[model samples]
Target: MNTRALSSIFTAELRLLVRNTAVAVSALLMPLVIGGMFVVSGLQQAPAAGWGFYVALMLLTVFGMSGCIAAAGTLTYRRDELYLKRLRCSEASDATILAGVLAPVVVVTVVQCLLMVVVTAVAAESLPANPVLLVAVIVFGTVCSVGLGMATTGFASSGEQAQTVATPVFFVLIGTAIWAATDLAEGLSTVQMLSPGGAVVQLTQLAYTGAPLSETASGALPALGGLVAWAVLGAGAAKRYFRWEPRH
Candidate 1:
C-alpha cells in the first residue's frame, strides 16, 4: 500500500462520505430499520443446529441492503463528479485510489457489524458463540460486498440511479439467503447452497448456534469454498469492468 497517498486519499474520501447523506444514512440508519424489522418478526426456533445459522443470516441481511447502498451510491457520486477521473490524474495509483474510495464503505460495514452484534446481544440475547468464525464471515462478507458494489458501478450513471441498479441484486442476495435458511422455502434446499449469501450465512449461522458443522469436512469445506469463490468473482469483476469514468 502507498501509505502517504493512501492516507490522503482515504481522508478525502472520508470527507466526501460525510457529506454524502445517502451513504451516511445507509451506513447508520438502515441497520436500525432492519434491526427493528428482525425484532418485530421475532426469532423462532428451528431444528437446525449451530449459532452460525442465525448470526450469518442476520449479518448477511444487514450487508445486502446497507452495504450495497453504500457501495453503489459512493461509486456513482465519485464517478459523476469526475472524482475518480480526477484521482487518476493525481499522484495516487489506481489501486491506491480505489482503496481510498472504498475505505468509507469498509469502515461503515465494519462499524455497522459491531453495532449489530452488540444490539443483538443486548436486545435479543443472541450472542456469537464463536467470535473468530463470526469475524471471518464478516471480513469476507465485507470484501465481497465492496467488490460487488464496485462491479455494479459499471451500470450506474448517477447517484440517483444507484437505488434502481442496486435493488435487484440486493433483493436477490437477501431474499435468497433468508428463504434458504428459513423454513419458508423448503423446496430449494439443494440449490440454496449455491446462492450468493448462501455460504456466508451458512457459515455465520454455524458460528452462532455452536453446531457441529465444523466436524464434517465434507460440508464445511464446500461452504468456505463457495464464499471464497464469490469473493474472488466479485473482486475479479471489479478489476476487469469497474469504470472510473462516466459511461457514454
Candidate 2:
C-alpha cells in the first residue's frame, strides 16, 4: 500500500469533512447531542442492564450516521465530482484509495463511540465490566458500518441520493439493535445474532454485563460471526458495483 498517498488522501478527506457543515453536524454533533440527552434523562437511573442499553443505542446511532451514512454520502460526492476518478489515476492502489477516503469516517465514528462510552459510564456511575470486549465491539462495529457504507455508494448516484438510499439501512440497523437489546423477539434470537445490527447490540450488552467470553461463547460467537459475514458481504458488493465517477 502507498502509505504516503493514503496519508495524503486521509488528510484531504478530513479537511473536507470539517468544511461540510451538514455532514459535520450529522456525523459529529448528533452523537454528542444524543449522548448528552441520555446523561440527563431517567435512563441513567435504570439498572445496570439499562446502562448497557444506552451504550448500545449510542453505538448504533454513531455507526448509522457517521460510519455508514456519512461514508456513503462523502464517497458519492467524491465520485460525482470526479475526485475518486482523479485518485484512481494516482499511484495509490484501489485499496489504499478506499482506505484513505473512508479512514476519516471510521476514525471519527470510533472516537464518538469511545466518547459515548465514557459519558455513559460517568452518567451511570460505572465503567464497562469488560473494557477490552467493548473496545473490540467498537472497532469491529465501525468496520462493519464502513463496509456497509461502501456498498451503499454503489447504489447512490449522488450525495443527496446517498442520504435517501441509506435511510432504510440506518433504520433497519437501529430497529434490529433495539430488538436485540430488548429481547422482544425471544424466538428470533438466532436471527438477531445473524444480523449486523443485532449482533453489535448483543455483543455490546454482553461486554457491559461482564459476561466472560467462554461463558457467553454460544451467543457471542454467533454475533461475531454475523458481524464478519455482513462485513464480507458488504465488501463484496462494493467491489462489484462501486463507481469511481458519475454515472453520466
Each prediction's Cα lDDT score?
A: 0.70, 0.78
lDDT of 1 by residue, 107-179 (tens): 8788777777776677667776656667877787777777877778788788868756766766777777776
For all predicted structures, in order, the TM-scores are 0.87, 0.91
Distance (Å) between predicted and true CA of 174, model 2? 0.8
Clashes of 1: 13
Give the alpha carbon lDDT tens digit for every residue of 45-156 in model 2.
6664446666777888888888888888889888898898898888999999989988999999999998988877766765777676677778777777777777777787
The residue pairs that clash in candidate 2, if any, are none
Runs with alpha carbons beyond 4 Å of true place in candidate 2: 42-45, 48-50, 184-188
